[model samples]
Target chain A: MDTVISAEDLTKKFGDFTAVDRISFEVFQGEIFGFLGANGAGKTTAMKMLTGLLRPTSGQAQVAGFDVYRQPELIKQHIGYMSQRFSLYEDLTVRENIEFYGGIYGLTFKEIRRKIPQLLHELGLLEVERQLVKSLPLGWKQRLAFSIALIHEPRIVFLDEPTGGVDPITRRQFWETIYQSAAMGVTIFVTTHYMDEAEYCHRVSMMAQGKIAALGPPKQLKQAFQAQSMDEIFLSIARGAK
Target chain B: MRTIFFILRKEFRQIFRHRVMLPMIFLMPIIQLLILSNAADFEVRNIYLHVVDRDLSPASRRLIGQFAASRHFVLTQTSFSAELGFRDLEANDADLVLEIPADFEKKLLRENEASLHLNVNAINATKAGLGQAYASAIIRDFNNNLRMEWLDMPDRQNPGRFDITHSFWFNPDLNYKAFMVPGILVMLVTLVGLFLAGINVVKEKEIGTIEQINVTPIHKSQFIVGKLLPFWIIANIELGMGLAFGKLVFHIPIAGSLWVVFGFAAIYLLVVLGMGLLISTVTETQQQSMFIAYFVLVVFIMMSGLFTPIESMPGWAQKVTWFNPIAYFVDVMRMVLLKGSGWYEIRQHVYAMLAMALAINTLAVLNYRKVGA
Candidate 1:
């Protein structure tokens, strides 16, 4: 397996408070990696460092074969990002949002035009492609945001609580899309609070107090912790830190 | 470059699609040019006057007629009692009260001098000062006429006198509208820069769209340029329309080359755009941006010599005007429009504004961080 993302004791500190401690991890290409942590456990901060949106205070990291410290802009060209919030332009229509992102990422107008029909069809937004994004349902907007993040065909897509505030059925459907993207050779590095969803990840890493308490597949982690569910494993790890 | 074009298209689409922006763009310059230009006129006129004619003589009547004949003062009341005229002044019914004593004409013929008591309202200091000046001029004219009629004083009055006649240049009428409309263009462009480029960028930060944009391959300068170019163009168009309106409506003279005015304005707007860019990069919310913009704008406008002459301000305040961005443009507007000044005359201001643009825009670009601090 080819490793696409590698970190060596990546850390970030804001003033006196340490948001992400000296910790390390790796993700193979075309694999689903779940980054699990409780609220304020530094999941979002760690993700920011990896996506070139923040500078690490200490240690080193590499994204898409580019140094996080030296080549963040080059790293930007190879990676896609989605945040917890709805980040698409609310005033812009569905198609304009796609074209805008595609254009900024250096896609030709002909390429964007060819990609729109299939992209909209896959997101089930073909009917409302011309409507303002604010007018779309929340589920549609989320899906469209995810698709727009992948508009440039990035090698690794960072999903930060992408399925947050989504209903259970929609969350499952969103995972199917994530699984499909991974199957097509896109590395999925996602952070979520949903423990059951972590069970679906090929490998899961549980963070507690800015440190990774456990790192393994869900089945192995469940057996190693003697827990029946991934939720129990997270609860035991969080308790052990205290 | 291509990315900037995309962002520019997006910005223009968003600006055009905004419901309030269209109206604000259309009505702001028009309303500012119409209402503010007319409202900001400081020339005092139509003063209400009440008179007490106790003498009831030809001289006293002639004095009253002189006051009435002048366009500045309106004769509101004329009575035999000085107390009645004072009451009118006290009741706010009259701006000034003139009381002629019973021996006013008798003393003038006997002693060649008679004192006329005048009461003036000083509530509005400018109006009061100007009104007093106009009244004194009329009185001085009446005194000169009275002396000219005295045949006995001919040898005394025959002494050589230095006569001074002054004529106003550029705008000979000294029309306030001609001056105000050009100043109004400065104000209009400033508002567009502050609210559009400044507030608009902060709004993206407020709505979390900037987070998405930051992660893209777009460069920081590209984003700032995209935000600035659209509003910069819009402000210039508004200025052009405002200048045309000034010519058509207020008949303000455009004595200098339009190219010089626009050239100075083009550079001046970079200073303003840099300010807006700096403001947006430092602030995170539209409200905070607005507060800062208002704070800067109020001080800059007040110190800009827009409403009052900068020379009239205290020494420290006049020194402060050197740093005020709007002051340079206000002076440029008046200089180019009213004085028919060419580039050589306004070159110093252009150099100052260019230095300001370089310093401010460099600061803005430096302050803008695509990554988190």
Candidate 2:
């Protein structure tokens, strides 16, 4: 399979501190790649570099066959992103938010009209299309945000802790959407703190203090650490002093 | 361009949906236009005068009547003693005092020259000077009449032999309301456009929606254009309403083309909205944005000659007014509305406003950070 994302010695620094140390990784097409880290473990910084939102201070990264530094605009056109926070406009209705994001991706009005029904139906959001996003529950907003992110049908979707404050059942449902997208030959590069959700990925890279501490499938990571579960494997690897 | 349109539509929808901001956006300008136009007058009229006529003579009475007959002064109170008139001045009930000598026209007849005591309150010294000048003119006219009566001539046009005629071009009547209404309209546009646009983006930053846009495929210029266009339209609508009120309610004349006023308003709105975007780019919170905007606006409005004449300001201050877009717009509106100035007369001001708009927008876009990090 072709590599959808490849970062060669990716690094980022802010003034005196290194937020993302030199690290390299690859994500194949249609693979759900989980980036697991603690609060300040540089997961967000790395993902930002990949999405062309921030320039890497050193080394290089490519997404959808475009250099991150030189071709950031072209890279942006083929990728979708959802932040950890509720990023949809609360005052706008669900359908309006979809239309806005779709428009930003350069989708024509006719294309947006064609995509809205299918997107809404898949997210189970057709009934609440007219409601303000603020009035919806957190779980539903998360789903809506994800749906909006994928409005342009990009090749890769970068989700930074997409299910941070959601409930367990809603999180399970959200993963179902992620899995469904991955099955359709779209790569998923997700960052999360939840170990159970990390287990759902095809491969995982656990980061600690701006460095990649471990990288493998969930079961392989567990076996390599001689642990019972992915949770123990994460704690054992992350607990050691940097 | 298409992305900008989308953003603009979203912003407009949000502004329209918010019930509280809608009234504030429309009503505040109208109310300010009504109150400020009335309050912000340069022509001093109906000045309260306290008179102490100890002489109780016909000459003194006639002199006092001259002041009263002139529409500028009203004899609010009269006292037999100077001490009583001073008391009234202290109480703020009177603005000026005219004290007549007790000799009862004896000095004028004997010496052929007499002087009356004129005491004026110095607080709000500008108004006091005007009041004193008006009183002095009245006394001079009375003296001239007395000289004519004593000579028993048909006309005493021997010595001075000069006629001075003054004419105001734009505002023939020199109505202060006519001068201020258009300037106040410009101020309202600047205040609303800059403050709301600055605070709106800062609110998004505080709420984290700005981060969402920062990471998206949306270009920074597109975002900036989208953010400012709604405010641009709203500001123009406000200009229209203010012009209508000025014409119908205040009886202000619109001597120039309405298109000229609107064209200037359109360019001026961009300058102010760009200023707001610059403020938003530097400030982190909505409160900080508003406070900074207020500080900048106060300076701009003061220097814009909204209340005082720009030409009367110090030379350095007058030079600074050239850069203030509010000054250009105010001057343009007043010239167009009152003077009937055409494109040639106001072309410099129009070009200056356009340059300011372009410069401010360029600076704002340059200062704007495309990436959050």
Candidate 3:
């Protein structure tokens, strides 16, 4: 696999506090890379620095063949970001949101018109295309947001807690969407607090207190930690963090 | 340009879709223009008067009759003591007290000159000043009449008093509403412009949509222009409606060409809306943006001289009005609507606003960050 994201001792500090400490990692193309951390474990911070949404205090990172700091605009053009807060204009109708996001990604009107029916048909959202996003259920909205983020069809897609607050059945279905994108040779960088979801990744890096405490395949990590499941592995690591 | 168009389309859709916002955007300004214009008048009338006549002679009685006859003053009471007249003034029953001294007719007949004292309520200073001028004029007219009748001076055909004939130019009737409607129209446009532009980007930030946009390849300048353009267009439309209401309802005359008024409004919106965008860039949430926008607007409106003349403010405050964008617009509207000032007459205000627009917009765009939240 080709290495798509390369980081060397990435760090970010806010005034006196360090949000993301000196941590380094690499992500290969067409692989599901899981970034697992607690609520304040700096997972989002590290992801921001890698995605060029934040400037690193020290060290350097290259994303999609562009430097994070010097070529942030270039990096932005090539990546799709679905933020933790579920970014979609709730007042806008489903079709309008698609058109807007598609437009912002430099998609032509013809291209967007061609993609809309296909996208809606694929997501089973064709029936409610004109309905406001605020009226949609939580599961459908999340699914639509994810699809909209991928509408640009960039090489890499970053999902920040994309399945948060959804039902377990919907979460399982959401994983299927992720697997489908990965099968299409799109690199996936996902951050989640769920241990079971972490098992779905090809490789996982666990962060604690602004630093990565462990990095390996989920199976190997569980085996190395002498834990029966990913949950125990995370619990044991979290215990050691204290 | 395409990106800006996309953003602009999205903004317009959102604004039109909001139920509460749609009504507020139109009705609030209309209501304010029709209703508040009436309440904001500064014309003083129906002054209450209490007269204390110490002399029972015909001269003093005739003098009292002159004040009673004038339409501006209403003789509310008659008092024998100056103390009681002062008490009525302090109690808010009377605005002025006319006190004639004892032996006033005897002094006027023998010595040929007599003086009367006037005690005026000065709490509302402008009202007091106008009332005093009316009283003094009536007294002067009375003195002239007495000189012509009692003195029998055919040789001195002209009285020695310097007859200063007052001529009011524009707004000759001094209709306060005419002076206020134009300034109020400017306020209506600004309220729409500043508050809308101020909260727009910050609302996106609060909702986490701004983070999504920040990671896009869209340029900051494109975003700033896109954000400001929608509100700019809406505010101008609001200004037009307000001006129409001012004309039809309040009967305000538009002296200068309508194009000149709109031209000034367009440039002035750039400055005010740019400041609003600047506020949004630094603020993280809509609430913060509202507070900062309101604080700046209060200072702006007070210094704008919409209700009070900027010249009447102290030196430092007047100097500060030179930087206020609202002040320039208010001045332009008044000069054009009341004085029929053309573009050449308002060229200085236009140039000042252009410089302000450029400086404020450049700084706002520079301060907007694509990264680091």
Tens digit of per-residue lDDT, candidate 2, span B42-137: 778988999999888889899888888999999998889999899989998889988997884988888887778888998988889899999888
C-alpha RMSD for every candidate: 2.0, 2.3, 1.8
> What stretches of model 1 exceed 4 Å from their correct place?
A239-242, B52-54, B77-93, B150-157, B160-162
RMSD of 1: 2.0
**Cα lDDT tens digits for candidate 1, B1-373:** 9899999999998999999998798677798779999999998889988988899999889988999999899999999887888888888898888889999989988899999888898787787788888888888788778877863556366777446799998779989999888987898888887778889899999998898998998999999989899988998888898899999998999999999989988998899989988999989898889889989988898888899999999999999998888999999999999999999999999999999999999999999998876
- The recovered share of true contacts, given per candidate in order, is 0.83, 0.63, 0.81
Q: Rank candidates, DockQ, best first.
A: 1, 3, 2
Docking class of 3: medium
Where is model 2 more than 4 Å wrong at Cα?
B65-71, B74-91, B148-154, B157-163
Tens-place lDDT digits, model 1, residues A1-242: 88899999999999999988998999999999999988888899998888888999999999999998999999999999999977999999999999899999999989999999989998888899999999987778888999999999999999999988879999998999999999999999999999889998999999988888899999999989999999899888888777
What TM-score does candidate 2 get on C-alpha atoms?
A: 0.94
**Docking level of model 1:** high
Proportion of native contacts present in model 2: 0.63
How far residue A175's Cα lies from its native spot in candidate 1, in Å, is 1.1
For model 2 chain B, the run of ten residues with the poorest summed lDDT: B153-162
Interface C-alpha RMSD after superposing true interface residues, each candidate, one decimal: 0.8, 1.6, 1.3
| CAPRI classification of candidate 2 | medium
User: Model 1 chain B: which ten-residue window has the lowest total lDDT?
Assistant: B150-159
- Who is ahead in TM-score, 2 or 3? 3
